[model samples]
Each structure stands twice: as structure tokens, then as C-alpha cells.
Target: MAVYTQVSAEALAAFLSRYDVGDLVSAKGIAEGVENSNYLVDTTRDRFILTLYEKRVAAGDLPFFMALLDHLAGKGLPVPPAVKDRDDREIQQLEGRPACLIRFLPGVSLSQPTPAQALAAGCALGGVHAAVADFEPTRANSMGIAQWRPLLERCGRDMDAIRTGLFDRVAAALDAVERDWPRDLPVGAIHADLFPDNVLMLGDEVTGLIDFYFACTDIRAYDVAVMHTSWTFNARGLNPSAGVGAALLDGYDRSFGLSAAERAALPVLARGACIRFLLSRAWDWLNTPADALVMRKDPLAYLARLDWYVANERAFA
Candidate 1:
């Protein structure tokens, strides 16, 4: 939002020139995310998303992420097919950063989406899980147990005091989670951050999904967890989103029915997803350099969701 991945017109032009589409008529920033500088490039041929990768996404993993999109697209899942260069490499260096261009998905992000659309997003995400199940691409999760555990370890010695009255059970949650969290239900690639903002809606239907940076091999239920966080939680931190969750779950069930184990783990996976984002936001806030244009997302947002989890811990059907 703050030009975190700044790209000048000259640089953008050069990036576009390498592709089949020629003559960038106009390039303007498209705002539906806090990370990555995304621009809608109107070319003489067609429109496309020109993304200048940011620090949050490491370039090394771009291949697997891009391939996953290709994989899903082949499966008839609603996803943007990553355009390849003449050399067939999914990623190329540009503007001193690893960059990519994807065909612009035709849809807009909805704020007051209908119940049908919410369910559609959920089901579509589930479709992704089904499509990519046993998907053997590459790229391990950048934020998995190994990464998450140490962050929790550092949070020991009263790091909870840093945020103050925030996420009191975070430590305990992590401990019990490591010991008891469902690990064997089903594991595969997940859109680990499938927030509403990351998905596009077209007339009460999910038309396209964006942001594969967080995609990786993990528990399938965690994907459901991330969706619940987005569609079911609000900024003030309330769980009035259950109806949305029901529609989502319904849609997901229609696509690929969850196992009994996955259903049982959904609430806990949702809680883990909540805390994962919560800790990431807090860490990013605390670690961001002073001059960075990237304004860290409010850690309070996730903390509120955590509270919502505690209040409705066993409320899900």
C-alpha cells in the first residue's frame, strides 16, 4: 500500500517487453493486498497483473508456487494460470527483484458478499485442496512447526507481557497444539492464507484466487481454518461469521467432503490459523525497520480473533 515494492514506469515497461503482450498502454497499481506491488497493465493485447515481489515472499520458492497455480488450473479449479516466459521459467529477475506477470483474473473483491458467495469461496478453496491433494511440487512451508515453534520459544519468559493482556493462552495453546494437533488426517498443499481479500468474487461466485505465496504442503484442515478466519471474523473481533462459515463449509463439503478427522480438527486448525497470523503480524510489527514503508498489519486484529476462538471454542457444528 505504501509502495513497498516500488517499480518505476521504465522498469515496468522493460518487464512487460519480455512477454508476448506488447505495448503497455497504461499501468496502474491495483489495491487488494498489503504485500507486493500489484499493477493492472493494460496492453494493446490484453490486461495482466504485473507484480513486483516484496520482501515477504522469497524468490527461491516462486517456482513451486507458480506451478501450483498451473496444477490447479489444469484441474479446472478457479485460479490464475501463471504465464511463462519464452524460456519457460515461471520467475525472472526484474527491477532488481524476482517478479512475475499473471493474466488478470476478471473479478473484484467483495466486502458485503452474499451467503452464496461466501460458500462459493469456501467450496472453491476446498476444491483446491482436493485438486492438489498428493500434489508433489516443491517448497516446504515457510511458516510451519519448525518456524512456529521457535517463535513460541522466544515468546516464553513473559513475551506475552510485551503485548500486555494479549493472547494469554498463546503459550499453552502452542504446547497443547504441538502435542495434540491432528497431523495425520490428510496432508497436502494448502492456500495457507485464503482470506476474502485474497479471493475475487463475480456476481455471487468465486471467479479467481490470488496470492500463492503462502501455499505449501500442510494439513488440509488448516486451509479451512484460514478461510474461517477471513469469512467468519471481523476487525472488532467477533464470531458472527459462523453463517458465513456454514456456507463455506457447505460449499467445501460439496466439492470434497472433509474426513471425520478433518471435521474434528477444523476448529483447532482454525484456532492455529488465527494464532499463526496473530504472531506473524506481531513479529513483523516488532521487527520491521523504521524506514520500511510496509505498515505491519494490526496484531490486535488476530488477538481479537483469538479471543473469539476462546468464546466460541466449541460452538462450531
Candidate 2:
């Protein structure tokens, strides 16, 4: 949802000509997220999201994402699929990048979600897991456990620039996570990045689960752990919301129950989640161009969550 590349009005209109979506009325760049160039496009017919893949999103993986979205939509999940053109093509070339025109889903992404909303999001996530149980396509989690240390190394000494002693803390956390990460757990297609902004809600119901760019085949419980860390924490990552966390897990369990082993692994899986984001953010913080139209997130936020998980391991137990 960032604009690394600018698309001119003329070029955009020309791109729209390939589709049956009607004449473009207006297109505005979206600057919230750190991946892909996104535009809120409106036409005579309706609105659609125009996304130009950028950064970590590989062009080779586009089909997997498209298939996953279509699969989820087919199973009644509130996921937006890429809109095909006159030639029935879902993927297209726009602004010298592989792009897609997605159906714009209704609902605002909540900044401060209530417990009820949290519960609904949990249920929606559980439903996604259930829906994808038989999904054959698999994409490896690029940011999974194995990539943590290498990502940190890529960050190098610049890590301490974000915070003193950040490097050692993240390195040590990585060691512990690598040692304790579970070998065998239920695996399936997971929305690896289930941050609150990724889930669209109308009232207490989840209207959409957007952003399948980071979706991959990974531990089912790891997805829960990622959601737990993202949803249960404040924006600043300073405080935990117990009621929201409890309700989220309860809702998920009610919809798609977790095995006893998965429950036992949550604490460790949570630590891995923390490390994953911590390193990626650190890398993005150091490397993302200053002029990019996206907010650079703080790596220390996840470091704080890592500390919380280390001290309160029993919270997940």
C-alpha cells in the first residue's frame, strides 16, 4: 500500500482501457503500508484497488496469491480477488511492474478495535484455516524461522541506531526461538501477516481479510500467534489488552479448535513471531528509501513484545 512508483493519469487511464471496468474517474495513491504501490481507483461502474507489486513481493509468486485469494473467496471467505480484464487476464503490466486490479471491498480497517471486533476477526481467521485445509498450492513462508538470523545479519550494526542493545537482544531471542520452535504442528495456508489493518470490519463482523501478499504455507498455530501479538498489543506496543486477547483466542477456538500441542507451542511460536517482525522492520527501517510514500515502522515495538512474551510465557499456556 505504498507508492514507490508513480502512475500518471494518462497511463492509468490507458491501463484501465484493457479492462471492462469503465472509464476512470479518479485514482489516488495509498500510502499506509510498506508493500506494493496501491491506488484507490474509481470508474463509472465502481471502485477497484490498483496494486503494483514492489519490494519483497516477487513477480513469480503472483499466481499463488491470485489462486489463494480465489480459493478463499470460493469457500465463502470475505477476500477480494483480482479482477480479470476483457481477455480474462487477472495479472497485467502497469508502470513497468506486474499489477492487478482487485475488487475494492467495503469496510474500514479499525485502528482501535473492540473486543467484539477482535473476536470476529479471530473467527474469520479460523474460518480461513478451515477453508484452506485442502488447498493444494503451497508457498513457503519467506519470513519464517529460518530467515530470522539472516535478516538480522542484513540489518547489521544499524540495529543499535534504532535502540541501544537492540542487536544483542534480537540475536539472543532468535537463538531461543530457533532452539525451541516446534518440529511438528498442523500446517496449512496461513495469512502470515494478520495485523489489524489487514482485516476489514463492518461493526463486529469481518467484512474482508485483505493483503494476501504475505500469505504462505506455515504452522496454523503460528498464524494465531502472529494475530495474538498484533491484535492484543497497543499501537505503540507498550500495553496488552487481556480481554481482547482472551476473546480472540476463544473465538478462534470455537470456530477452529487448536490441538493441545498447538496450545503448548503458542508461547514459543509468539516469540518467533516477534523475532520475525523485529528483524524485518529493522531491515526495512535501514533500507527503505526515505522518499517512499510509506511509514517506516519501529523495530523496537516488536522487541518490546518479545520481552513481554519472554517474561509472561505462561500467558499463552
Candidate 3:
């Protein structure tokens, strides 16, 4: 969540009048994520999240996100669905950007998760894949492999500005991943970006899975790969935990069994995941507005992850 667009108090009050959520008690902009503009909104009745779609979030994709959340919530998953207004509209214009009021879920996002938490998160992710098996709506992975090269090209030589020789390393990794990318893996709707922050946890139990903005139809194992990269490593992309990684895989296997092909392709899938984040972070590092309320993540973190994945592919395989 980020705050690129500032919503005025009068404008916010007028917008809330359309809903039955009650008078606004307080609203604060969230400045953690690099995606949409988010506000922690509290009304007389309850707390909620106000998200304004920005950056890579397309307006046409809002319905897909809302429907996916609704479907997950209906399946007993702890996903926050978009709250509809008095006119039953979930998507509306706020500050000239497509916005939605999300039901506030109670939990804290873990920065340094333990093995047990990783297990629960993995199980929850597997359950999501299972629940979405019959979800008919299809939205392509906008940040998929096909878009990586162009994103990197957009970053261009500036990649090395973050770190010496970063550009070439990423480019070589991208080439290898694209050339040897897997085919015919199990495909389904996936959260796509299951970083630890996206998961809301109470102790070891996953109370909520927030931020489905990057959710899409993609290789099921790719989601696992994304989680593997995100959950098993420290924020600096150092100090990988074998215990956490093992627990995560075990939990997912128990919840939703992985086929042999999926298991065999994990190493490559993991490298692809690394490349995806590396390029996106590189782009964001160079281009994100100087005055944006969001923190500019270091692209080198993913580069470090990419290096680790390349060296440790055999272990994953």
C-alpha cells in the first residue's frame, strides 16, 4: 500500500456518504507497499481499508480482484472482500482513481516469520489454489515472464546504478530462465505475490491473506516458488532458513499435493520468481516518484536472491 494520490477530508466524507459504513472517524495513508494508494480508514461502525488503484493496477482488473476475494471469502478463507456501497457498487471513483472500501481484517503482517508461520502461510496458499480451481474468471499474469525483458529494458543501464554488474547478471539469468522455462505445469488462479507482508498472521495461524492485487491465472507451482523465495529468506535477501523452507513445502504438500512435474520444476520456477521481482524492483527503484509516500525497495535484494537461486537450483530440484 502507498499514497500517491492524496484524498481531501471533504472529498473522503462525501465518498463515504454513498455507503452505509457510517461517519469517518479517522483515515491515514499507508506507505509500505509500492502498488496502489491505501488508507487505513475507520468509521463509526468498524475499521476498513481504502485502496486507490494506481501504477500497474488496471481499472478493468478491479472486478477480477473483487470477485476473487468474494470467492475466497465464500470458501471460508480469511480474505477481505470489497464492501459495497448503498447502491451496491464495490468499485467507485475516488480522487479520480478507481477505489474500493475493503473490510478490515484483524491481524499483523510478520516481517520475520518463523517456521510454523511459514507452514500456515503455505497451507493457506495451497487452499487458495484449491478454492480457485472452479473460479471461471481468468486474468492473465500481467507481470509474467513475457513482460520481464521489456521491464528490464525500461530500467536499461540504470540497473547498475543500484549495484555494479547488476544489469548483466539479471539479463543472463533472464535469458536462462526464459530459454528453459517449464511448460504444461498445473495452471490455476494464484496469489502470484505471496510475500510475507501480504499474509496477515496471529502467531502461527494465518488469520488473513491480504493484497490480491497481483493475483492472476498462472502456473500453480509458481505461487509456491514465489512464497519459497519470500518466506524463507530474510528481508535483506540473506540468511535463508532451511527449516522454514522445509516446513513451507511440507505444509503445501499436505494441503494441496504437488505433482512430480511441479516438484521437478521448482528450481527453475524459483529462478523465474527471482527474476520477476528483480526486474520490477529495478524499475521501481529508478522510476518511482521522488516524493511518493512508499519506500523504494532495493533491487539488489532480488539480485542476491537470483544469485542464490542460480547456485542452489539443484537443492530445490
TM-score of each: 0.90, 0.99, 0.99
Each model's lDDT comes to: 0.75, 0.91, 0.91
Which pairs of residues have clashing backbones in candidate 3? 1-33
Runs in model 1 lying further than 4 Å from the true structure: 30-32, 152-162, 167-169, 289-295
lDDT of 3 by residue, 1-317 (tens): 89999999899999999999899899999999899999999889999999999958999999999999999999999999999999999999999999999999988998888999988988998899889988999999999999999998888888888888888888888899999899899899999999999999888899999999989999999999999999988888988999899889888998998888998999999999999998888888888998899987777788778789888877564
The list of candidate 2 runs beyond 4 A from truth reads none
Tens-digit lDDT string for candidate 2 (23-97): 999999999888899999999999999999985899999999999999999998999999999999999998899
lDDT of 1 by residue, 124-243 (tens): 887887888657885677887657667755555344555775545676666666676786787788888887777888788788898888888888788887887777766545646667
Better of 1 and 2 by lDDT: 2
lDDT of candidate 3 vs native? 0.91
Residue 158 lDDT in model 1?
48
CA lDDT, candidate 1, residue 165 = 52
